[model samples]
Target: MDEELKKMLVKILENQEEFKAEIRKHTEAITSLDEKIMQRTEALFDGYKINSEKIDELTDKIDDLRFDVNNLGIKTLKSENKILELDRRLAK
Candidate 1:
């Protein structure tokens, strides 16, 4: 082969090797970013689940408190009725 042509071929081969190396770096970076995104997504889901559980617990407590309040109201009404009955009997 002619010397000039040989040098050109050598340069082309070198350029190709450099391009391949650059592509490999980009692929590796993309893979790393994908992994990080997945991890972040998982963490967010876990946080959401914890928050949901807390909300459920709070709801249950509120329900229990409401039930107690209703019972207390019923008891108060009964006491008032008894007081009125006793007062009427004494007056008679």
Candidate 2:
């Protein structure tokens, strides 16, 4: 009976060791997965930042174009007035 008990205890100890090893493997896998997720998240944020900067640059360019168009309109109106004045003087 004592021998049987001893054999059972040995079996339990072997099972415990296997369980510990499996736990270690799972922990390592989780750690590796977490690292990969962090790397991907950082990369995604970088892409977002770059896209945001480009959008801002495009918006500034659009504003500049609007300003230039407004200036052109003003110049065109002035030229029209000058041409009308010239026509009136010629009529005299």
Candidate 3:
């Protein structure tokens, strides 16, 4: 009966050690996962910042194009008026 009790006690201690080891492994895994999550979050924010800058640049370019088009329209109107005046002079 004594030997049987000793064997049971030893088995319980071995199981306790295995449980501790498993808990350590799980803790390490959680820590690693947390680090990875932080890295990915930082990367996502960086991408967003880059995209926002690009959008602002594109908007500025569009504004420049609009200004050029407006200037061209005004020049065209002036040229038409000059041509009409020349036609009137020729008629006289």
Candidate 4:
């Protein structure tokens, strides 16, 4: 009976050692995956920042163009008024 107990205890210890090895392997794999995910996430964030900057630049350019068009419209109206006045003088 004592020999049987000793055999069972040895088997349990061997199983425990194998379980520990497996856990170590899984931990290493998890660490590698985490590093890869972090690298990709950082790259994606950088791309988003660059694209946002480009969008802001385009918005500013569009605003400047709108301002120029409004000023041109006003100048065109004044020129037309002057032309009309000259035409009236000529008629007189």
Candidate 5:
């Protein structure tokens, strides 16, 4: 009976060691995944920043183009008026 008890006690100790090992493995895996997630999140933020800057630059360029187009339209109107005035004078 004593030998049987000893065997059971030894088995329990072995199982405990296995359990600890498994826990360590899980902890390491969780830590690795956390690090990878942080890296990906940082990369996303960096990409967002770069894209935001590009958008601002494009917006400024579009504003400048719009201003130039408005000026061109005014010039076209002035030219048309002058052509009409010349026609009136020739008719007279």
Candidate 6:
């Protein structure tokens, strides 16, 4: 082969090596990014689990409050009836 052709072939081989190295670097970077994304997704799911538990706790507390309010209403009605009975006796 001529000197010029040999030099051209050497340059082409160098370019191919450089391109292959760049592709390998990019592949490693992509793999790292995927791992990071998976970690972030897991963290988000954990946060959601915690929030769901808190919501369930609050719901139970609200139910307890409702039960207490119903008991209070029954007690108030009994007291009012007693007062009415006393007023009727005094009027007689």
List TM-score per model, in order: 0.80, 0.82, 0.74, 0.88, 0.80, 0.78
State the lDDT of candidate 4 residue by residue for 1-92, as single tens digits: 99999999999999999999999999999999999999999999999999999999999999999999999999999999999999999999
Q: Candidate 6 lDDT, tens digit per residue, 1-92?
A: 69999999999999999999999999999999999999999999999999999999999999999999999999999999999999999999
Report the CA-based lDDT of candidate 6 relative to the real structure: 0.99
- Number of the candidate with higher lDDT, 1 or 2: 2
Model 1 pairs whose backbones collide:
none
Q: In order, what is each prediction's RMSD in angstroms? A: 2.3, 1.8, 2.3, 1.4, 1.9, 2.1
Q: Determine which window of 10 residues in candidate 3 has minimal summed lDDT.
A: 82-91
Tens digits of per-residue lDDT for model 5 on 1-92?
99999999999999999999999999999999999999999999999999999999999999999999999999999999999999999999
Taking the tens digit of each residue's C-alpha lDDT, what string does model 2 give over 1-92? 99999999999999999999999999999999999999999999999999999999999999999999999999999999999999999999
List where candidate 3 sits over 4 angstroms from the true fold: 1-13
Clashing pairs in 5: none
Q: Is candidate 4 or candidate 6 better by lDDT?
A: 4
- Candidate 5 total steric clashes: 0
Whole-structure CA lDDT of model 5:
1.00
Candidate 1 Cα outliers beyond 4 Å, as residue runs:
1-12
lDDT for residue 83 in candidate 6, whole number 0-100: 97
**Compared with the true structure, what per-residue lDDT tens digits does model 1 show for residues 1-92?**
59999999999999999999999999999999999999999999999999999999999999999999999999999999999999999999
- In model 1, what is the error at residue 16, expressed in angstroms? 3.0
Candidate 6 runs further than 4 Å off: 1-9
TM-score of 5: 0.80
